[model samples]
Target: MGPVAALSALGDRTFGSLRRHRNYRLFFAGSGISFIGTWMQQIAAYWLILELTNSPVAVGALALVQTLPVTLFALVGGSIADRVDLRKMVIACETTMGIQAALLCFLALSGVIAPWQLYVLGLAQGVAVALNAPARHTLVFQIVGRDDLTNAIALSASLGTTARILGPAAGGIVVAAFGPGVAFGLNAVSYAIVIAAILAIRLAPRPQRTAPLPGILGSVGQTFRYAVSTRRVAVTFFTLILVSTFSFNFDVLLPLVARLTLDSGAQTFGLIASVFGAGALTGSLVLATVGRTRMLLVLVGALGFGALQLLLARQDSLPAVCGLLYLIGIFYIIWGSSSLATLQLAAPEHLRGRAASLYFFGFMGGAPLGGLIAGSLTAHGGTRLAFTVAGAMAILIAGVGSIVLLLGRSARARRPRTARESAGV
Candidate 1:
């Protein structure tokens, strides 16, 4: 095939899910715009924190404030998703988030913004995230059904990756030219677009609860039991805990890496994030096309994710750091998308909402502590020490996982053959 033909073919494969599913297409297109604004706000928020406090610990504290709500409330949110009106829940939560964004913008514009207020607003936004995650994630399964679910999910991730690529770069420029408050205002408006899209969606109705509904706590308990019993999910969740706690502190670490280590500002910070997002976007597209859910490949990608970061710790220049970040982002998405699909696939449809929430439970659970660790390391030692510890921990967790899986395969391989196989036809 010619080069242009190859590009077209790749595009077709990458977006196959959108072509097949109308509802997902709407979700993807609308969410795509909002995601860009989300990324922009993320970049601006991190920059603002740094400017106000000039303390690395405060940056990590910001992560803690946002994620602690997820840890505390996500399980309950998942239970509500399984039983309630998902579309309505999502709309309500998103509106709350938009209001929080508007408040932040007002504070910033008025010259009264402080770290404490930022933390308080972030806590409110985090509650919305806690409520929103399960409903929003599970809603996709209803839209596209099981067979096409992974592809749709991967495509959604690709959308987020694309937003990441655009958002930070734009945010960096905006912050430099305008200010962080303006970026926050843009985010507030972006939520309306997504809300309109959600209102446009029509889902196939599901059966009403025919029996007495289980208590919310009971339903959540059931999900916990199911996940622990499912070996693949258990392992994957463990890995997420490890990686999320350590390797995923980029928002906390990167600003310091840019301002202190690289002697740069918002543009460079945005560039660093955008470059990683580009590589992550590539990885998401590849996964959307292939849509693999095998456990082995997930571990391999995670190990590579960790290994690349080990190399990242040694780099001091922009080119070198960005290059390493790009590769790490590829492995990051590969591991992330594969494992997420695997966990969702493992659950029965009724329990899928809670299962999805459990995924984030592991995914975002340790992040608060991890942010603190990253911040402390950077404050005391430097970015080098922070990256070194994160990289090493990821390597350790993924490496152990790989070794256990291989040994299990080997043990099964050595077991006695079946009578039919021993007799040989």
Candidate 2:
């Protein structure tokens, strides 16, 4: 083929997942639209809290309330996903989210919204997310099948990153022009689009399970045990816990970095965030084209993420900070997408929901504690010190994980063969 044709073919293969699947296309379009609003709401909410309280700790506390439900109930969500119709579950969750967003809009527009009220609304939103996340993730597998799972996941991440790029900038404009109330109202409308798309797509019928389902507590325990039984899953979960807890408090970190460190405001914060999203979008596209996941990618991504954070901590200029955040975003997506793909691929079909939930628990469950630590550190020591601590923790976790992985590989290579191998059959 000619050069142009070769390039065109490559592009087709890179995006084949979206082109081949009708349901996924609808999902992609719907989710893309909705996520833009979601991120807008996120930026507005963070800024709103900061405007109201002018305290990083208060921001962290809000984050804690938002994520604590995931920590406590995500396993149950997983259990429910395994037993229920995921389509119905997701629709219900989206509707609930819409209601919550409407309530926030009403509160904000009425001029009676308080910090405590934001917390209550945040908690409500968190519950919907906790219930929805597992089903939403597992639904990708059903839509695209295992062959395209990696690409679908990468595309989905790319869509979300794209939304991040657009949403924050739009949010900055909306907040500056109208108010956070308008942003909340936009988010409320976004959910309707997602619901409409969900209603339009027809899912394949699921096979009924003959075995009895476990109770919620039992289900939670079973997932925990299953995760620990596999070395790779265990290691992935452990690394994620460390990274998510220490490193992924960007909502709390970025605004403070803009205001306190860079001496900037909402627009600057949005710009920095959009730059990071741009980098993440680039990374996700790369993954989508690669069409596969690798644990090595996850490990290297974590290491690079830590190194960039270290560099970010030392930088003072806005340009320098933006540059570092861009690099951080790329590595962050690599780490996150690869880790999730790895865990999902390792899980059996029946356990996939539970496994995904475990992954979410590790990734988001620690946010409460992480937010508290970050807020406290930022309050007491400053943003630089907080970044320093987060970077160091990530590096330490990655370093230890690398050693463990290497030793495990070495031990396996040196071990004696099984009886079947020795029998030469």
Query: Tell me, what's the RMSD of every candidate?
Result: 3.5, 2.3
TM-score quality measure for candidate 1: 0.94
Please list the C-alpha lDDT of all candidates, in the order they appear: 0.86, 0.89
> Candidate 1: lDDT of 154?
82
**lDDT of candidate 1 over 115-199, digit per residue (tens):** 9999999999888999898889899988888878778878888788888889999999999999999999999999999999999
lDDT of 2: 0.89
Which candidate number has the best TM-score? 2
- TM-score per candidate, in order? 0.94, 0.97
Worst 10-residue stretch by lDDT in candidate 1? Answer: 416-425
Tell me which residue pairs clash in candidate 2.
none
Question: In model 1, which regions exceed 4 Å deviation?
Answer: 1-10, 208-213, 410-425
